[model samples]
Target: MTVEHREAAAQRQEAGAGGPQAAPGRRRVALLFPGQGAQQPGMALGLYRADPRFAARVDEVLALWGAEGRAVRRDWLAPDAPDVPLDDLRRAQPLLFAVDWALGRTVLDWGVRPDALLGHSVGEVAAAALAGVLTLAEAAAVMADRVHHLASAPPGGMLAVAGAPEQVAGLLGEGVVVGAVNGPRQVVVAGAEAPLAAAEARLRAAGLNTRRARTLSAFHSPVVAPAAALGLPVLRSVALRPPRLALHSGYTGGLLDAATAVDPGFWAGQPAAPVLFGPALDGLLAEGRWLLVEAGPAQGLTMLAKRHRAVASGDSAAVALLPARPGDDGREAAAAAAVRDRLAAEALLPV
Candidate 1:
């Protein structure tokens, strides 16, 4: 095997900490969710029809969180909400979480329970809710409060890195750090503009590839330290439970226990920590077969899953790319239907 593959194997073996497993006779599957920048207009429309309970649960969450007033406007209920007022990060974070939560909840109500759950960046909040670590309302409230807290912090940004982790880390010496390792080489870095620029220059100098992320704020890096540090009170107020499923920590690929999982210090430190998406996938793969479901509005996680599968299988020919089109209901239905079909084909559903 290649050196990279060997490293991935090592990470799998070291991904210690046991979380809940799926019930007997049920094949292990993971429900993945995308974080910020994955939000699109009319995110919950498919679930709104595919499962009525999805809308009901979201309504319950809205009522419980006292955010019922900001419902997705009547016109925004279509497949795209480009004109809707989700421009503000404060509004967007909760809204995106709501959309992603609806997707996961509908899957559950439809009798498709995941063995584990993992969310990227802001999606981690939704994953916490799906794992029963946080209630829907509580997740929404914390996310809203988090966005509010982040806004007052100094400006910073995230950039996507298309290289190995060690190499990327080498390029970012002082301030910038890896935010999310979405795939083998698809990683993100966060830091202030100057540091990020320097890191980018160094990476390019080394012939490494990079792309600036769509995010306006630098999250999961030291840039968010001040904001997260000051937001301790809010984090402490949110009651968190030990995840009932294998909810991999974004800060590390290892599983989290109740004491550390629910601690405010953990969340506070997350902004400055490296995201272990690739390692988390390795840990999941080490267990058994898996049919990854992107339980969110966008297909970013799906894309990442495809990348990992290709890397693991070492057969690009065996991979399939499913793209989600903008403002297309038939496309959404087809995609969800395909997901259902694939889950059954893989015997991932409880018979």
Candidate 2:
């Protein structure tokens, strides 16, 4: 194995060493919610169709947005429906928020309680709801209003760069900003399309992997500052509460402070704040033996979690509750069963 792979394996083994065998019943587990690019037209269709509880929860959250929610549900469920609106930031944010939140709630109802929670990008809204820091309606409102403000901004794009932040930092030019640090080797840069495309071309020319993320605006960059400012009042209107679960902040790259969690200004700035996922994962890994569950429509976060040094080293395991792609036959049920089986085997869930 390469040195990097070897190191990751070691970390994983160290993380998994004592807990599963010593006190399986109390094994630690962390829940992760994904952000944009994770959405699909038929995502969660199986779960929503076969599981009434799951469907009801999805509807309940969707109801919070009124007509927009209903329209999203229609497109999300209809056969042969195009993912047109799902690509629009204004609509996508709230829809993804509801789906991810519903999935988390469904897992909780199935007795799979998380010991900690982390969220990526807009996924943080759902995480906040699950942590009891915000209600479903409030999260919906935050997401919708945030997107509304964002829609008013000029068009931009994001590029997923497969390199360390330090490596990519030097490549950024005017308008470009580090949108997210997903892992040691995975960073997302966002800005106007012209600058973003130029950066991606340069990175690829240098033999670094780069791809355009499916997004409408340059989220987590200076481009969204105006939107963030506009959304501040909307964010402040929502009531805040202390998290019922341990909540990690992707924006801060660590556990969220209680004071900051309840601050509207903190949330207001989050729209344009870089997602510090890698550092946040490091913090969660320090707690030891966590089962990182991706509670969203896609396995994007789960894939990133698996590549983390901790998981690669065998210090932890990561699983996705849903398929990364839309249209996979029975994949959702299979994924859910896989999670259930793993939790049961670890004694985290009652058999």
Cα lDDT of model 1 by residue, 72-96, tens digit: 3343464245443554455556666
Model number with the top lDDT: 2
Worst 10 residues of 2 by lDDT: 17-26
Candidate 2 regions off by >4 Å? 1-26
Global lDDT of each candidate: 0.67, 0.80
lDDT value, residue 216 of candidate 1 = 68
Task: Tell me the number of clashing residue pairs for each predicted model.
Answer: 3, 12
> lDDT, candidate 1, residue 205?
91
TM-score of each: 0.80, 0.90
RMSD of each: 5.5, 5.7
